[model samples]
Target: MRFSRAIATAVATAALAGSAAVCVPASAATPSTVAINAGGSAISASGTSYSADKGNIGGRTSTTTVASGTTDSALYQSVRYGMSGYSIPVTNGTYDVTLKMVENYWSAAGKRVFDVSAEGSAALSDLDPFQIAGGKNKAAQRTFTTTVKDGKLDLAFKADQDNASIAAILITPKTTATPAPAPAPAVGINAGGSAISASGTSYSADKGNIGGRTSTTTVASGTTDSALYQSVRYGMSGYSIPVTNGTYDVTLKMVENYWSAAGKRVFDVSAEGSAALSDLDPFQIAGGKNKAAQRTFTTTVKDGKLDLAFKADQDNASIAAILI
Candidate 1:
């Protein structure tokens, strides 16, 4: 995919502000690293050099003492508040992104609720630094892996309650691996995004006439197939797949990446015009947000087509991947 022209325009603007928005090539042999202090000046700590405030929008700096448990307190001491987000330039590749944060203003949870998106896809939803770090001045960090086909990684922060803020940013390149072949007698589909190969199984990119929307948010735990669960199709009515007339076991992978509570999302699944799973709550089954859960059922396809229907009881229906 070609780089977004809007990103190129932003990078040109960052150039006038003395920001590090240069497009640098990154490879496996010598991968490039990026570190930036959100609202502070340039500094070097722990043998890593951090750039000064750059590539940000509509924010100011605030200095405060950071609590223990982290050696790099300077990184978390100065934060940029009231900013929309950041757009940093880099070569097209996959990178591991880490955001350093602290709740210096609010003491209790729910005071600051926001979401983090990378490349226009959800990376984190409803994040609270105070609750995650156990205190106001404590450090809280969130990390995720995302691919960047464009020449830049655009991050957006939308606050639900309070103003959005961040202390520092770290972006490191990752080595790409060879893709594996798909297994026979099994059809795997990454429900709402690009194709992915994981756990010796190759899943193709999402393709079907399903009536719904798609999302790309990373899941926290409970499975090694994070790529499979990171993307999903939500608010769908049903999907139909052509198959041989035989009995087959179908697995529907799911995760609740939006809501934290259990009763937020509930749905039912039916296969071949019969009940397969009744009232499936992903958050309740997985115990929390950003966790993986699944449901499997056996059905006989007599009409040479496997029909799967989903009906929502709560928010909406969501599915990450499908296997048959």
Candidate 2:
């Protein structure tokens, strides 16, 4: 997603030193629904127009593409780092606050530590975006429901070490209706390997006319099923699981057993010919090789079958197991 790193760093250093002033809104937007691209210019994402970096803070930009969860990589390419907090003017009422964070700078855990407080109470503590996200250039978010009494919705970033940072902030009025929980899937696959049981789920061994090569290796962490993760199918094209017409949650059980670093093994996942995951880095999302990482997506089976496709961006695409 690499830009002119040297130049961007120099420019950010200067602005971070206090050259950038707090920007006031132009009265063209609503205060209840607010989206801010923390350290970057104004951009639109998912039909929402996020304002330019506002409040009293500093920001830096990166060229790396944000992995998974969001299609708008630009929203997370820049970050408002080393900030004490932000004071955003908002309508007084109950609101859902969502903070979009990405570790574009640090790679290892504990390198950056911070806590965030909404209004005056703590909302997120001991936050390590890199650790929480598993790797850099990955998306991580925290949402909290809060009531804003004052004219402004105050946020404080208490830096425990290096500096506190944020990529974007979104505020929206809470809805009255609470959506029902997602229903679990009834299908599971071992993906090019033999079927085995783990974590109370019975995964069928390489189901749904699998077309890939299978291998075995040890998985480090993130699941109780080491056997499930140990067996993997690489260079697989896709899978077509037969099921009754209905919507279900599909979870891809994955681990990076070959590639040791991010970007080495990157790919995209498709469900029913629609993009499910883009630029999915197993090594990055799972934190490291042999570590368990899984992504759950909801899709509907219309043709009495669930069609899934995998396209590789870097090396060969792979997966350990599948839960449909």
Candidate 3:
């Protein structure tokens, strides 16, 4: 499947910002040797059986290791030109994943392209090593954190414009604590915008590093009724709030602080694709600029998540706060 251009842009932007965005926690990375291989039998020259690459003999490429932390230079040839990564044993918990690669083939970009997904979430979209490393025969390392829940943390390399290849896969434990079966009452960000902690909640679409998943644009704590106002998140068009399968009252705290005039700010809000609010205008509801307004709608969240999708008419959509 193809990657969403919007999500790809969001992730690429975050990567350039050195934030890893929703892909990883902001902590020092230390990847242990989970598995590594070039292409062949599940054995390396150094006799590292656990780290051999499950290979597609037809797609094997010859490459030399740069001698950084690699165990076997010849063992780095096990390329998964076909098939997804699940040959190793894994458990539920946070992990530091490091995909080691050196340009063994292809001199320029677009020669090799693939999509990477970890634990059913997009880690990298339209990945091209030649582009990431600037050229072939060079070394490049892509690191991120992923949590395994279903016995094994699946890392799939789906063919994009071209085949996906990996010289080796390194997975290291992040923390000693076991992954929680279910998180606490999902982060219902209170008023007054501040940086959203990555450890807070699992996000989708609009959910980002700063604001659940995306960075929050505004924090309304003291300007108006500080008691009523809180932090607000705005960025992409779609967002998902993680929650257990159940029904709950979803409240929206709206403010006409940004757009002063009517029709200047118009958008649609939906829950599970059903129209909850059509052509919602905060300025109209609040009656004037810098006024506070709110609306509430109750809906059931199936699949352990509540999707909040927005579409703008005149300007971008916003959320001052959400209370569950």
Candidate 4:
């Protein structure tokens, strides 16, 4: 028996600069059905094209079953036996796989027992087709829902008693994944303030205080200022940003509003006592005063926090925000 395929629509939304956009994929392909004639020759039936003995080439048994399926179809007349099964080509996604079987040579349960797996995941174990179909030479079926992302569907059979056999195969496309859930808050800091929170992330500047830093200062004209960049700090002191011990992407949000050129406010930055940004100058990156500059680097933090220290070279160092 065959089942109809139905797909569910998914949607995702992204916000940038106070505006939103909706996006979707190019749409997935229809389900692919590959019917294989287990041990027999190939022929199409019931509007489905059948492949002949594509897998387990040398493991085939030439013996034809004296018993025949009551359905009186060519597919029910022959079958193949093997220790391992086949690998069918497919696209990346979830699918529904159906295997058709008929107990031919083995009329007893334990005479031909085996296990089945789909793409390395367990599908069935200790399978006894003869027992499942009520002890005889009859037709039976097993179905499983699985995901295929590595470009193929592997139907593997490991024999426990004698060997495993199959008569036909049916594959159909299953529903795709829906949009992911909203992300958690990010971690960040407002230079002189206690903690700044936004976009599912939190920022803080309350680990160790750096001298010459003011919590009530404002940015200069033409400089970046928002909820995340409201406060400003200037000095040549070391400041530690509290964060869980691990590797993180660190971003230093700054502006050269106080200086007109690169060499005026050069500073060396270190995270966890390691040099991350050496001789970094916002004016050099943005090319002028009152322009914003952002520097990003990766570092490892230990002992439940990250330590960020700044050493001034030519002039005093300044920062508006720190994001992790």
Best by TM-score: 2
Off by over 4 Å in 2: 1-31, 40-78, 84-95, 101-162, 178-206, 222-227, 243-250, 259-266, 278-281, 295-301, 312-315
Give the TM-score of each candidate. 0.47, 0.60, 0.38, 0.43
**Alpha-carbon local distance difference test for all models:** 0.81, 0.80, 0.60, 0.68
Error of 2 at 195 (Å): 6.3
Tell me the tens digit of each residue's lDDT in model 3 across 51-135.
Answer: 4444223454444444423445444444546555543556556788877665566765567777888878888776676555544
Clashing pairs in 1: none
Residue lDDT tens for model 1, 155-235 = 999999788888888988876676655433777888888989978988888876369999886545567778788999999
Which segments of model 4 are wrong by more than 4 Å? 1-29, 62-68, 175-324
Judged by lDDT relative to the true structure, which candidate is superior, 1 or 3?
A: 1
lDDT of 2 by residue, 276-315 (tens): 8766777776668888877777788889999999999998
Of candidate 2, the 10-residue stretch with the lowest lDDT total is: 21-30
- Give me the displacement of residue 148 in model 4, in angstroms: 0.7
Which candidate achieves the best lDDT against the true structure?
A: 1
**Worst window of 10 by summed lDDT in candidate 1:** 20-29
Residue-by-residue lDDT tens digits, candidate 4, 137-211: 666677789988777788788889887877777777775557755543456667766676645567665445467
Query: Is 2 or 4 the stronger prediction by lDDT?
Result: 2
